[model samples]
Every structure is written in structure tokens, then in C-alpha cells.
Target: MKILVFCGFIFFLAIFPLSGAGFELKTVIDQVSRQVVVPAAPQRVIALAPSITEIIFALEQENRLKGVTAYSDFPKKALKLPKVGSYVYLDLERIVSLKPDLCIAIKDGNPKEAVDKLESIGIPVYAVNPKNIETVINTVVEIGGLLNASKKADALAKNMRHRIKRVEALIAKTDLRPGIFFQIGIAPIVSVGTDTFIHELIIKAGGRNLAEGPVSYPRFSREQVLALAPDIIIITSMARSVVFEQVKAEWNKWPNMPAVKTGRIFLEDSNLFDRPTPRLVDGLELLLKLIHPELINEANKCL
Candidate 1:
């Protein structure tokens, strides 16, 4: 009877571990979309988007980045990393050679087939799509969690929230809200409308978007733009040649426009404005300065 009891106790110990299982930790899901699962703390990470690379660097996980895309120009050190081609077209051979455990990509930037191929080869991929400022913060936190830098990510997110609140407070003190028109791409004349990250930024920067009614990025007619009569016109210098001289000359022809008459046309770095990362705080501060230079004190001029 003593031997049987001892055997039963051993059996119970073995089954207890399996039954309780210590409650397996739940994998975090990407908030933008529930489909993607954050991989367990990646060691060798490849950032397919410049924005993702910036976020990783902000989280101080630059050492973990095995490879980065061609356009990641920030931090200067990122330039030394091996290039994985452009966001739209990746160098599959180079990526496979690097043997990265995980690849971080943007939703629209990376191709579906490339992601599938990487997954088939036993590499995990986390595709992030941050449509607005709030989502951008969440993406950073998620990336941090995936990289085992949860504390850093939380701190970064908190800092960004505080900066945004400061900007909001400044805007609320004044009733002056300028009507803004943001130019995304010229030539065909693409502009940020409602439901765009840029549109949200404009609102946060204490400016009202002139391009409304249309949801996503839409091409505007010259006549339609004239009708909006924006108080301030902001153009992104994303293109190789920011042709500010040419743009100013063209706007000069439209004498009736408020922006043209008042010379409220300003140029901003497209990468900083368009990329949804921690640097976006810089862009917001710049936007505020441009929109209401009067609110900025003499000491804040350096900003």
C-alpha cells in the first residue's frame, strides 16, 4: 500500500504540470489588424520600412536590427546596415542570407507574396499599419513588446502623448484655427483628405483641413483647390528637388488666394511628416511653430 501511494503521488506531480500549464502567456495581436500576431521577442530583426527602423532605434534596439531597407536614412548608423532593397520590392536572396528571425514591415509598403515567402521559410513577420497618431503610439509599444523592450516602449509612448498634450494645450488657449491645405504629391496634385494620418496631424497642429468630403488621398482639381481657399499651404519636400521657388512662383500667379497673398506657404520634410514614428513629434512641433509662430517664445525659436 505504501509503494502504491508513492507511485500515485509521482503520477499526480507529472500530470499537474500538464494540467495547470502555468497559464501560457497570450501573444499580443497587432491593434491595427487582429490578423497578425507579435512574435516572441525577436533577436535578429529586419526592418523593411524606414519608419519601423526609426521606431526600433527609438526603442534603443538598433543592435538587434540585422537588416534595413534602402530608405532608412536616419541615425546615420543605419546607413551602415545591409540594404534589403526598397519597401515595395525586397531582395529575397539577401534577406534569406541574413537569416533574420523576424521581419518587420508596413502594411502597404511590403508585398503580400514576399511576406508569405518569408513566413514559409520559418521567418516570422509583423505587418503594422498605423493610420493615425494614436495608432502610431500603439505600434511603437507593440514593436517594443516584440523586441522585449516593453519599458522603453511605454516610456516612448508616454513622452509622445505628453508632447501631443502640450501641443493641444497651446492650441486650445487660442481661438485661431487656420484652414490648411497639405500637398502630398505634386504633378497629379495629390492632397491629404479626411481619414489620412496627415489629416490628423494637421488637426492636432491646430489647423483645419481644406480637403474634405473625399476620404483617402485624392487628386484635387485646380478649381476645387481654389474654392477651398486655404489660409495656409504646406508642401512636403519628399521629392528629390523641392522646387519651392517654382511652387512659390506658381502660387504667386493666384493673386486671389489667401495663402498666396499672405505668403503662408511653408515647406516641411516629407519623411518626417509622412513617416509615423517618434520623430512625428518633431514634425508636430514644427507644424505648430509654422502655424502660429506668435505662440512660440523667443527662447523656443531654436525648436
Candidate 2:
């Protein structure tokens, strides 16, 4: 099955961007390992995860991307890059062959040994661990510092934070928030919980997530779903038509369900909510529209 979250549940632990720029020289700290001095502006970079790759593009540093893993298909041009491997397994040989000066890998999406191996070979590696929206925003700014593009990165981060506050304000105005259930997987139904970014998105979008347990992605029985009585049901598309159809069919079986009756069902892009990139704002905006149908026009204008 094509699960939405990466194998790590979150990105790997290390990503430290220290300030010291002049003639391509700066010391970077990793969340888990030793510090490494990177060239001020690394021209050849390898992105170990799709989220990292997305950040590189968001910073307008795509020209420096030497390699990326599979499923880094958003920008259209990324599909043409050399494939290092997937989020869990990376081809060490291919990555080494590319001779990347700097490697960016997620804490959870990448294996520690791979990152260690990259460093063993004298390749400067920066690991990132963005657990929440604030860290995600800070990480973007950190990346800018690492690449000597702090200004651009800060500008982007500022814009994102501004929009997020706007969304929060929008949610605050309405006293009635809908009970929401977001479906990520089918056949024993997997959904995000309190520990995941998706859960945070739901809250920020003004919807109360019914899956409130500590488990990042919890499984729910059909009976439990009925018990929760979600006013709205949202299904995520993982580029798979079969799973989506199944989710829709399963929910439709209960015509009396609040979500089914009210026609508040929605299908959203997995990338927008899954990846911790600038696109998260897009996800938030979309969710506001889905959860509160009345604010569709206002949400459209806010963005």
C-alpha cells in the first residue's frame, strides 16, 4: 500500500545552520552527529528526501540539485534528475558517483548509516528534523543560511508564517468547528493522529480531528468511525485511484452518516499535507475550505 507518511514517521534528527559566510565557508551542525564546515554556496547538492528536495526548489536552488530520490516529481523538472534511491533505501554507489559537495537528508526519511557513510567519504551532510509547523518554517530559513541565501529563505519563511497566522485567525472567528476524519489508508483504515503534522493541519484549519490518540497514524474500525460521527470526511490521494475509490465506496455505504448526508466529503492532494514544505500553506488553505464550506470565498481571498 502507498502510505502517506515516510518510513521514519518524520525526517531524520539533525539539521543545524550556523552563521559564518564569506568565500564559501560555514560550519553546520547536525541534530545527531558531528559538525561539518560546508562551502558558502554549494553548487552540487544531493537531496536524500522529497521534502528536502522541495525546500531546495522553494529556495530557488534547483539548479544546484545534483541528485534526488524517487517520487520527487512535483516541479516536473525534478523527475529528470539522477535518482539516489527512495526515502528508506539510498543507492550509496549512485550517490557517491554524483560527487555532491553537500547532502541534505531527513532524519526519519533517511537511514543514519547512509548519512554516516556519506560523511565518512568526506561529503558534508546536514540532517533535518522538523517536528512541527514552526520548526518547518525555521528549517527553511536554516537551509537558506546553509546555502548563503539567508535573505531569500527568511522572506519565504516570513510569508508562510504570515499566511498560517491568517488561517489561525480565520478559524478563531467561527465558534462552530466541524468534527473531521482524514483518511490516509484503506482496508482497516489508517488515519493521522495527534503526533503527526496532518493532525496539526486539521486543527489549524479549524476542524477537530477525531483521531486523538498518541499514535502518529492509527487504525480505526468502521464501527469506531461511525461512533466518532465526523461531520466531514477527507480522503487523501496518493496517486492511486484504487485506494481512493475504495475509501469513497466504503464511506458511501452509510448514507445516514453526517459527512455522507451533508456532502462534506473531500479528496485532497497527499503532497500538500504530507511534505513539510512551503506547500503546507496550500494544504491549510484547502482544508479551511473543506472543513468550513461557508468560508470558501473568504479562504480563497486570504491566500
Candidate 3:
């Protein structure tokens, strides 16, 4: 997972740029309350973050996407798009070369300087900041509105809400909240805190996050983790699959650990957990299944 931290969500409207041949220039506010002028029907757009690219693709607005940041390799087609560098370290020259009429950025990941520089050079940048599942759905809808795909965005948002409610309803039926140790970093042995998306998912999926605190992604020693005695250990890393298996094997050595004893240590796709996209709902359901296998049938029904 790309570690792009987030805050609360914001709502904004679309505006038309007057200079673009047939388009009119109009000012609109972004998620961060920054005023941007863009074309009403932007033909060339750039996604400054992988998650933003995913959202635009989900909205079926990829036709306007002229460029995307590195690792925006979802939907298969994004692989063919021009790269403007990663979200954190943006390539201003490459981005400017693309001649994009609009650029969608994530407030958390995309560097502020890059955004300001783009705006200064007459490139309209719309930003989004989605901190949790609910806001992520809102972001989908908001991006849809920005791209003239409100109908699709609304439908997608509705579907996301439906799935989230299903998880909530199913979770309400159980008092079984497993103590979970979610490891995101394998080298230094790090876990999510209460403020992170994974921690929120854990709680919503009926698992108690053992690493909940103020420090966001916190590091821990093996002894410290064992002392916590988590019921389930879920490891999500950007590392290769073999590395995950090796980590699992290492955890298996601790037979006394409940998760190892019960063969509950699992490896998951980090993107589903970290990316602030519609796929997070998918991650939530997966967490539900892992935390409570007994609810598999009911969870399927909920889906």
C-alpha cells in the first residue's frame, strides 16, 4: 500500500475555463478550499495520485485522463497512461508537458508545492481528502461531479453505502470482536493506529485493533506484539508474495500465540486496505471473513 495519510472529506463543485477554445473559465473550490479555474468539460486531465486514478476509473472518466502518477496500474488500462511520477514526488516538467486541462490530486499524498506550482502555471488542480470509508464514497461521488459523471458517481456511491450498511448490520449481530494485530510494515514491524483507514476497517469489521493510539503507524518489537496476545495477526505489505509467506512462517514458530495456534495469520492486499477507493469495502468484507469465519454465510448474504 502507498502510505498516503488522510484527513476529513470536503465537497466542491465544477467550473468551466473560458480560455479553452469552446470552454468557459469558471472558478471552483477544491477539497482543501483552494480556488481553481478549470474547463467545464475538461478533455485532458491528470491524476496526481494512484487512488485518484482508481476513483476516476471507477467513475468511467478515464477518457479525460491524459496522465497519471506512477503505480496507477489498476483497471489494466491505466498501465498505458503517461506517467507524471509518484504522488509524493511529482514530476512538474512531465506533468506540464502533458498539457492537462485539469489535475486531480489527493490532499494527503500529492505534495502541496507541486499543486501550487501547477495552479500558478494555469493548470487547474482539484484535490480530494478521504479519511474513512464514508468519505471515500463521497470522494467517488465528488470526483464524478467534477468529471460530468454524476450519475455514475451517485450509483457507485449508493452501491458502496449499501455494502457498508450490510457490513454494519452483520457486525451488529455479533458480539465477537477479535483482538487483531494488523502488521503493515514487516521490516521494522509496524502496525496501524486508530487514525488510519486499516484501524477503522478493523473496528468496523468486528476486530479490536491492538495498536490503536495517536502515533498513526507505530513500530513494535516481537516481544511487545506477543505481549499484546492478538487473536488474529494480519500482515499487509508491499513486499512480494514470497516475503509474506516467509513472514507467516516466522509467525508460525510462535505456537503459543493464539493466531498461530489457530492458523489465523493471514496475508492481504495492501492496496485494498490503504487505498482510499471503493475497493476498501471489499477489504472490509475480507476482514469480516477473516475475523469471523462463522459469519461467512451471513456475510455473503449481506454482500
- Please report the candidate that would top lDDT against the real structure: 3
lDDT by residue (tens digit), candidate 1, 83-187: 989999998767766767678888867898988766555556778988878889999998888888999999999999999998888888778889998987677
For model 3, residues 1-303, the per-residue Cα lDDT tens digits are: 122210010011113221354666677787788777778888899999999999999999899999998999887999999999899999877776676788999989888898877765567788988988888988998888888899999999999889888888888889989999999898899999999999999999999999999999999999999999989999987776997899998888889999988889888889999999999999998998999887878656767
Model 1 regions lying over 4 Å from their true place: 1-28, 31-41, 240-242, 298-303
**Which residue pairs in model 2 clash with each other?**
11-107, 11-108, 12-106, 12-107, 12-108, 13-107, 14-31, 14-127, 24-40, 25-40
What's the lDDT for candidate 2? 0.82
Q: Rate the local accuracy (lDDT) of all candidates.
A: 0.79, 0.82, 0.85
| Candidate 3 segments whose C-alpha is farther than 4 A from its true place | 1-21, 298-303
So what's the TM-score on candidate 2? 0.88
Ranking by TM-score: 3, 2, 1
Candidate 2 lDDT for residue 51: 90
**Model 1: lDDT of residue 15:** 54
How well is each residue in 1-303 modelled by candidate 2, as lDDT tens digits? 122222222122123122122236778686555687787788888999999889989998899999999999978889999998897999876776676778888897799888876675566788888888888898899888877778899899999989998888777878887899998877668899898888899999998999978898999999999999999998887756777677778789999899999877778788999898888888998898888767767657778
Model 2 vs truth, CA RMSD: 7.3
lDDT of 3 at 136: 92
TM-score of each: 0.84, 0.88, 0.91
Best by TM-score: 3
